[model samples]
Target: MANSPVSPSTNDDSAENAAHGKGRPTPSRAEQEAARKRPLVANTKEERARARAELQARREKARVGMEKGDDRYLPVRDKGPQRRWVRDYVDAGWHLSEWVMPMMVLVIIASLVPNVTVAYWSFLVLWVYIIFAVGNMIFLGVRVKRKAAEKFGAERREKGLGWYAAMRSLQMRFMRLPKPQVKRGQYPE
Candidate 1:
C-alpha cells in the first residue's frame, strides 16, 4: 500500500474490450522507487547551530532589504523627530508597579464611597491626585534616565532637556540632597 500507484480503472477505457474483460493497467515504477529511498540521519549540535545561524542571517537580510515606507513591511524608518522622540520615551523602560494597579482599584472603591465628604469632593481630589502621581512617576522615570545619561556624560538635548529638568527638579525637591555647591577654586564641580 505504501508504494501504490494511481488507479488505472479511472483512465480512458475501451467499451468493446469491456465485454472481453481485457485491460492490463500500467505500473508506475518511478513513484514506487521514490517511496523506497532511505530516511535522513539525525543532526549534530554543530549542524543545528549552523542551520540556526543561516536562518537568522536570512531573516536579518530580509528585514534589512526592505524599503523605508513599504506598505508590505512594518516601515522600519522613523517618520520625523517627534515620532523618534516618542519612540525613545517608550524605550526608556517606564513601567507602573504591581501595587499601583491594586491601589487604583482602591481609588475606584474610594470614589464610589457613599459618604459625602469622602466620596463627593474627595473622589475628584483623589482622582486628580492619582493622575498626578502616575504622571509624576513616569516623569521621574524619564528624568532619572536623563540624569543618569547626563551624569555619565551622554547627550542631554537628545534626552529632552525640558522634561528631564522638570523631573530632576521634582526628584531633588523630594530627596532634599544638597546640590554640589562648587566654589570658584573647585575644579571637579
Candidate 2:
C-alpha cells in the first residue's frame, strides 16, 4: 500500500517532520506589526506596476512644485539650502587639493624651464580631468540623495546612503585607514 505524503512516519520525510509539528503557535502582536512595517518585496507584475505608478506620481508632484518655484517638495537644483553644504565642501576641497597642489607642483616643476614644458602642460590637463571626474561623482551622489528625498521620502532617501558610505570608505582607504567590515554574526548598525 502507498503511504500518505502528510504522514511524517514516512522514512523519506522524517527529518522535516522532526523540525516542525502539525500545529504552530501564532505570532505575537509585535511580530505582526513589524511584518506590516517591513517593505513589500514585489513578486508579481501587478505589484511592480502599482509601485511604478506610485513612483511616477511622486515625480510628477515634485516636477510641478519645482516649475512653480516652490521647492517645498522638489529637489533643490544648482542653488538651494540643501546644496549649500555640498557646494561649499566640494568647492573648497577641490580648490585646496584637487586644484591647488597639482597646479602648484606643475608650475614649480616647469619653473626650471626644462625642455618638457609641453609635457608639464599635458600633465596639468590630466590633473584637471581627474578633478572634474571626482567632482562629478560627488555631485551625482548628492543630487541622487536630494532627488530621492524629494520624490519619495526621507526613508527612501536613506536607501542610497550605503553608496555614500562606501565612497567615504574609499576616501579613507587612500588615507591608510582600514576598510570597514562585519564581525561574525554582527550586521549593519
Candidate 3:
C-alpha cells in the first residue's frame, strides 16, 4: 500500500501544466494584443490639449461654412436644395409682415399715451393690423408652397417649407441668416 503508484491527494507541479498554463487556458496572441489596445479619447494632459485644439479648428471651419451656406456645415433644418430655394423665393419678394413689428411697437407707444381716446384707437388699430398680418402670412405661405412645388416638383418639396418661406419673408431681408443670397427681385429659377 505504501509503494502504490496512485495517490488520492497528489500535489503535482508538472512540467506540462507549467508549459501549457495552470489554472486557466492561455490567451491567443491576437487576444493579448486586443487587451493592450487603448481607447480613442485623450488620456494625458498633452493629448487633451491637442484634442481641444483640433476641436476648436473643426468648430471654426464649421462656423465659416455655415456663414457661407455650405451644405456640409449647415444645420439639418437649413440644409437641402428645397430650403435654399425657399430662402431665395422669400428673399425675392416683399411682404407686409416685415413691417408688422415696427408698427406694433409704434402702436404700443401710442397706447401708452395719457389720452384715453388715443389709447383706445391704438389698441383697435393694433388688433386690426395683427389680423391683417396673420392673413397676409397665410397667403404668402400658400403662394410660396405652390411656387416651390412648380419649380422643385411636388414630391421633392419639404413639408414645412411654406411656413419656413413665410417666416423668412416676415423677417427683414438683411437680418435673415444665410444672408439672403438672392437680392430682392432676383427670383430663383
Candidate 4:
C-alpha cells in the first residue's frame, strides 16, 4: 500500500468529466418526450408532397427487388426457403394447366362450327382438360408437400399449399413473376 501509485477520486475530476459531456446523468422522461415531440401533420403542401415522393421511391425499389426475387423485398407469401423451393419445383415442370388457355381458344373455335356433334365434343374436350388440370395440380401439391417434408419438416407439409400451387401452375411459365430460375425438366433436388 505504501508503494502503490493510486490516486483517490476527487470533485475536481467529476467537474472535468461533466465539462466534457462524459458520464452525465440521463435525461428525465419529460425531457426525452419533449425531444421526441413532432407536429401531428405536415406544416406545408411541399412537405406532404416530399413525403409522398419518398414513399413512392421506396415502393418502386421494393417492386424491382421483388421482381428480381430478392428475399429482403419479397412479400410474406413469397418469402422463405420453403417457398423458393416450391417455386423452383413448380417452375421446373410442365403442367396440363399450361395448355388450358390455348385449348380454350381452340375449343371456342371448334364450338362455333354449325354441327351439334362438334360443339358437344369440343365442350367435352374442354371439360376433360379442366379435370386433367385439376388432377395435375393436386398431384403437384402432394409431391411438393412430400418433398418439402423430407427436406424441411412436417410443419411445412401441413401448411396450406393447394391453392398457391394451383395458382402458379395455372399461370403461363413466361408470365409468372420472379421468372423461372430453373429450366424445364430440371427439377430441384
Residues 1-189, model 1: lDDT tens digits: 498787656534657556765366655899778888764752688877888899999777656543232224334333333323333333333233213445556767877887767766655765676677567666755654565465445653344543533343333221312222222233221
Q: Write the per-residue lDDT of candidate 2 for residues 33-143, one digit (tens) a residue.
A: 988895569888999999999999999887666544353753434234333323323322322233444565666666567568776676777677667656766665665
Order the candidates by TM-score, highest first.
3, 4, 1, 2
Q: What TM-score fits each model?
A: 0.29, 0.26, 0.68, 0.67
Question: Mind giving the per-residue lDDT tens digits that candidate 3 earns over 93-137?
Answer: 888788888888998899788999998988888889878888888
Better structure of 1 and 4 per TM-score: 4
Give the better candidate number (2 or 3) by TM-score. 3
Top-TM-score candidate index: 3
Worst 10 residues of 3 by lDDT: 8-17
Cα deviation of 179, candidate 4, in Å:
2.2
**C-alpha lDDT of all candidate models, in order:** 0.48, 0.50, 0.84, 0.85
Stretches of candidate 3 exceeding 4 Å from the true structure: 1-57
All candidates: CA RMSD in angstroms?
A: 18.2, 20.6, 8.5, 8.4
lDDT (10s digit) by residue, model 4, range 1-189: 489876878765676686776477889999999999999999999999999999999999988888778899987888777788888889989999978999999999998999999999999989999999989998988888788889877874547665677788889998887778899999888
Using lDDT as the yardstick, the better of models 1 and 4 is 4
